[model samples]
Target: MEPINLDKIAFQITLHGGNSKDLAYDALKAAKEGDFDKAENLLEEADKEFNEGHKVHSKALRSDDKENRIVPTLLLLHAKDHLMAARSEITLIKELIELHKKID
Candidate 1:
């Protein structure tokens, strides 16, 4: 396999991550308001975006050694922030759905 350039991969990952975060936020909003189908669709879209970032991440992992890790970049920090938000949204949505189920 060809090695991924750290700089280029980081840019792509960051964009996808940011988009995924937005989708996740929307998903959670829809879920909270009992729009389960819309919420599910939004979550699926977010997962697709997350998977794109995961692709870049997997490439980085494939290309890097412990001693050769890429330097920290703002893009990476932004990506991490988005990833954190998305993960949080997924967890919160799951809980919200369960609570809704109980209420119904």
Candidate 2:
């Protein structure tokens, strides 16, 4: 089997996760401005980006399982942080958008 490029995987996760988080925030802003259509579109885009990052992370985990172990690294840790933060922010932003709609 080919060796895993942990750095590349981590970078991909970080990139996609960060994009997801940024997009989610933008969605929230659009919702607050009463642009529900734009907000929903942005949220969809954010979900796609988050899925891309999650796919990369899952692949790494699967590879690790097959190899019996994968060494921890600072970059990997940071990538995981981004992944988690993006997920949480996305969920919260969606709820906030709904609340904004109700309030408006």
Candidate with the greatest TM-score versus the true structure: 2
State in Å the error of residue 13, model 1: 1.6
Question: What's the TM-score of every candidate structure?
Answer: 0.70, 0.94
Give lDDT tens digits, candidate 1, residues 1-104: 56446667777787787788788778767867888888789888888998888887776766676657667677666766766676666667667766765675
Clashing pairs in 1: none
Error of 1 at 28 (Å): 1.6
Candidate whose lDDT is highest: 2
Q: Which segments of candidate 1 are over 4 A away from where they belong?
A: 1-4, 65-81
* Residue 90 lDDT in candidate 1: 67
RMSD of each: 3.0, 1.2
- Candidate 2 — what's its lDDT? 0.95
Candidate 1 accuracy as TM-score = 0.70
Worst 10 residues of 2 by lDDT: 63-72
